[model samples]
Target chain A: MKLNDEEIALRAGELGPLRQWAIAHQIKVGDYLGARDFVAVGQAHIMADTESLGAAGVDWLERWAALPAEHRLVRIPTITDPRGTDFAHAAQLKQQPWMLDLERRAIAAFEALGVLMTDTCINYQTIMPPVRGEHMAYGDTGVVIYSNSVCGARSNFEGGPSALSAGLTGRTPRYGYHLDERRLATFLVELSWTPRELSDWGALGGVVGRLAGDYSQVPALLGLDRVPSADQLKHFGAALASFGSVALFHMVGVTPEAMRLEDVVPAGTSLKTHDVGEVDIRALQARYAKDVDAVDVVVFSAPQLSLVEIRTLAAMLDGRRATIPLFAVTSPQVKPDCDRMGLTARIEAAGGTVLSGMCFYQSYAREIAEANGWSRLATNSAKLTNILGGYGYRPVLLPMEQCVAAACAGGKLT
Target chain B: MSGEIYYAAAGMGRKVRAKALVASDGFSARYDLDRIRGVFSRPEHKLAGESYQGRVLVLDAAKGGVATAWMLHEMASRGVMPAALVLNRANPIMVQGAALADFTMISGFDVDITHAIPNGAEVEIDPTAQRPFIRVI
Candidate 1:
């Protein structure tokens, strides 16, 4: 990869050992991806929850943190994804002490390096939304997909190490979604029905994701009658990134890059087109619903709730009393607003816990499930449903209203 | 099957020989693995409940989450990792994970690599070759 004087200096250890390591890591990734050169990025978002990091990763960070402060500080504005535990609710979630210890260490390390502990997956909604064509090194799959597809920002699926490297280096390899030729539609998806609810939208995205199948295939979607809300797009993009490993999608007339199909689709290029309908979305939800009526818990998370989504939840739980635990996680930025507006109180009054700064799955989900005897889970998040199945839970994907209903009725779907 | 060989577009880490845990399903450390038990724990996955330790994983693509990029190195640190990863296609997350862990990985094949290699077949993956490949032995 071609490097400027600054990059050469960093690679040569003229900058500190930490930056030398960072540049080396970037070079390896750039070489593998065929990046011709490095491109300066505006910001970086890291997904380094304690569950993913484990003790080894935390210790590794601590090693870097031990370096002189000047050598380790990030050059650009760097933020974090949802942490593994919300300190306020760690005991309630039944996370082990060791997990908390590791989280604290990781947090301390990040702070030493000048990273903001935003602890959010929905940073696009809560933090600054990237402008069209803005370059970023974002770590969360949901963040990458949303920033790339809806916000028209350019980012690849930068993992924890890679994003941190970019944060330290202030640049990333120009490859994948950063390049124009790679952003063109590889597949065409025609929708017969636009979704009515968030879950339906997520199911639709899941169907598209499954069809796209790989990160390299970009899908161009059509047939939407109206514009969907930000929360709607959040669920759709998160599920698509989760189920398909896709980084970007173009909604023919919706997203910024695709004012029309022709804007993203090159002339004379033939694409494999598939049609998706209401039945397909229903089938995708039904696959998880199979013969399960009772759940141990109800959750509203994955991409943390927006203020509008919180308002909707508060309205649904106004007169209800939940017999099972219902967790409603939102960004730290939204949590204070929810509290000030009494949304949090209403949710808590209905036997629900409005968590902040942490996603449920990123927490020690399996361990908490074992502690709470929560195996049958109900949620409105298709991305969470797709993930929790591996963590030994039977996750049923339902709409927000239905999930609230289950929580109020002793976790019974009926 | 012993002499059959398949090539990959890119590769990393040292050559490895292990039994192939072949599946057409996608892989993600955060979504599909129980690293503590070294098994594919996701119920919907083709290799659910199967142990993946020290085996060569033949899968369709990398799916779900950015956590795998760190989890792979964590798993390798504990010495409970797959011998190598052979995929039909790989995402940036997988490549970054393999790079950090210094683990054997090869991806981008002409044919469906999962279908070409049978499950339980002893395979030798040479990622250091000028042309990286996996051969059924």
Candidate 2:
């Protein structure tokens, strides 16, 4: 990788050991991914949940945090993804004390390095949305996919370590989505039917994601009757990134990049085209709920709920009483608004719990499942269903109304 | 076939020799692993219920979330991790994770590496070579 004078200075330890280490790490990644040079990123979002960043990762952060403030502070605006636990609801989630302690240590270490504890995956919706053509280093696959596909910002799947390195150095390796040529559609997806509900949109994403297969392939959708809302795209992009390791996608007409199919797909280019209809989406959702007639818990998360999503959920729960645990997880930014609008009280009045700044699967899911003896999980999130299978949960993907109905019917599918 | 060698387009970390666990399935530390047991725990995974510790994981692609970036480091700290990873394709998360943990990983090949290498075969992965490769030995 070609380094400029500033990079050379950082490499030579003229800045500090922390910056030196950050640059070295970035160089290693750049060399591996065939990056020719470095690109300046406007912002960096780090995903450092204690569950992912075990003892060693936290210790690693603390070592840097112990450095002088001048040497350790992030060069660019850096924020965080949803943490492992919401401290206020830790006891309620049955997360062990050690887990909480680790979380606190990780938080302190990040704070020392000047990282904002935004604790959100919906940062594109809550925090500043990136403008088209802007480059960023973002963690959380959902954030990367949404920001790239929906917002037209450029980013790869910058993980926890890479995002922190970008924050420290204010730049990332210029490769992958940063290159314009890499953004073209490798696979073409034609939609035979459009989805109405968020869950259906997510199911559509899952179906399309299975076809996209990997990070390198970008799928361009050709048909959509109307423009879907941001929240709909949120679920779709999150599920797509989760099910597939895809970073960027073009929606032909909906997204910023591909205003027309020709914009992403050159004229006369032959691509592997897949046609997805209502049955394909329904089939994907049906596979998750196959033998499960009932569930122990119903959660709405994985991208965390937007304000509008929260309001819709609150409205659905207004007149119903839940017999099973139903969790509505939202971002910290949306939580305040939910409170101000009495959405929180309405959700709680229906015997549901509203968790803030924490996602279901990210929050020590396996441990919580064991603690609560919850094996059959129900959620409206296709992404959650795709994830919880490894955590020993039989997750059923349903619409928000059906999930609310299940919560009211003692976890029964009816 | 025992002495056959396959080269990778990109690689990092030291060379390692271990038994190969071949699968045509994708890998994600958070989505497909039970780190405590050091086994492929996802029921849908082809290597489900199989121990992955100290083996060369020759798999299809890197799939799913960013958690794998920190997970490789965490798994290495506990001494529960693959000896090396040889994949047909890799995502940034996998490359970043391998970089942080200093874990041996080589990806991008002329053919599907999973089919090239047999399961449980003794293999040597040399990432430091001018042209990184995995050899059946």
Candidate 3:
């Protein structure tokens, strides 16, 4: 990797020990990916939930945090993904004391490093949306896919350590999605059906993701009858990234980069093409619904709920009462608006818990499942359904309305 | 005597010899692992019900969420993780995790590494080279 003067200085420990370590980390990753140079990134997002970090990761961060303030402060604007536990609702979720302790320690460490606790995967929706071709070091896969596809930003999956390094150094190794040639569509998907519901859109994403198979394949989708909403694309992109490890996608007419079919698709490029229809989405959802008639819990999360989604969920719960635990997780940025608009009240009034600043799966999900005896889970999030199986939950992927209905009938789906 | 050797585009960490756990499937520590049990727990995974602790995992590609970035370090701290990772192609998350954990990893192979290396074969990976490689001994 070619190092500029500033990078050379940082690597030589002229800047600080913190920066020296950061640059060294960047150089290693750059060398691995064959990055020719470093690209200046506008922002950085870190995903450091204690569930993923554990005690060792927290201790590692503390070691860095103990450095002098000037040495540890982030150079660029840095934010965080959802935390492992929302302190207010920790008891309700039944997260253990050790988990809460770990979350607190991790939060303190990040705060010392000057990272904002934005705690959101839907930062594109609630926070800053990057402009076309803007470079960023974003941690969450959902954030990377949405920003790259819809916002036309360039980023690879930076992860927690890499994003923090970029934040400290204000640049990242230029590779993967940062290169324009890699953005070209490698395949095509002809959609036979345009999904109406968010869950349907998510199911479509899961199907297309399975078809793409890996992070290297970018699929350009066509045949959409209308423009999908932000929330719809949110579910779709989140599920696609979760199921496939894909960082970027192009919707031929919907997304910014693929305004026309020819824009992203190279001239005369013979690409592998697949067709997705309503049955494909149904079949994908049915794969998660094996022998599940009763749900232990119903959650609307993964890529936390948008304001409009919150309103829609509140409306659905207005005249209904839930007999089982139903959780509606949203970001800290939107939680105030939900409260001011009574969306939160309406949701809580119907026996639902409106959690803020934390995603369910990231919040010690396995421990909570064990503490609550929650084996059967129902959610509107395809991403959650794809993730929770290994956590010992029988997760059922359903639409928002069906999830609400399941919550009302004491966890019975039928 | 030296056996078959395959060079990787890049690599990191120290050399080690371990039984190869070969699978032509993608890997994500968060999605396909039961961290407590030290096994592949995701039902749909090709290596479901198989133990992965201390083995060299040779897979097709890196897959799923960003949690694996921190998870490798966390898993390493608990002393329950693969001895090393050898992939045909790896996403940035896998590289980031390997870097932070200081774990042995070699990727970007010319051939399908999972198919080339047989499961249960004793393999040694030496990553301290300009062009790192793995060998079946």
Task: Please write out the lDDT profile of model 3 over residues A1-414, one tens digit for every residue.
Answer: 999999999999988998999999999999888899999999999999998998999999999999999899999999999998789999998888888899889999999999998999999998899999999999999999999999999999999999999999999999999999999999899998999999899888899888888888898999999999999999999989988888889998789999988899768878888988999999999988988889999999989999999999999999999999999999999999999999999999999999999999999888899999899999989999999988888999998999999999999997
Ranking by lDDT: 2, 1, 3
TM-score versus the correct structure, for each prediction: 0.99, 0.99, 0.98
Task: Name the regions of candidate 3 deviating beyond 4 angstroms.
Answer: none
Residue A30 displacement (Å), model 3: 0.7
Give the clashing residue pairs of candidate 2, or none. none
lDDT of 1 by residue, A1-414 (tens): 999999999999998999999999898888877899999999999999988988889989999999998899999999999998889988988888989998999999999999999999998988899999999999999999999999999999999999999999999999999999999999999999999799998888899999999999999999998998888999999999988999999998799999999998889989999999999999999999998979999999999999999999999999889999999999999999999999999999999999999999999999999999999999999999999999999999999999999999999997
Question: On lDDT, who's better, 2 or 3?
Answer: 2
Task: Tell me the TM-score of candidate 1's A chain.
Answer: 0.99
Distance from true position, residue A300, model 1, in Å?
Answer: 0.5
Q: What DockQ class does candidate 1 belong to?
A: high
User: What TM-score does prediction 1 earn?
Assistant: 0.99
Docking class of 2: high
Model 2 residue A92 lDDT?
85
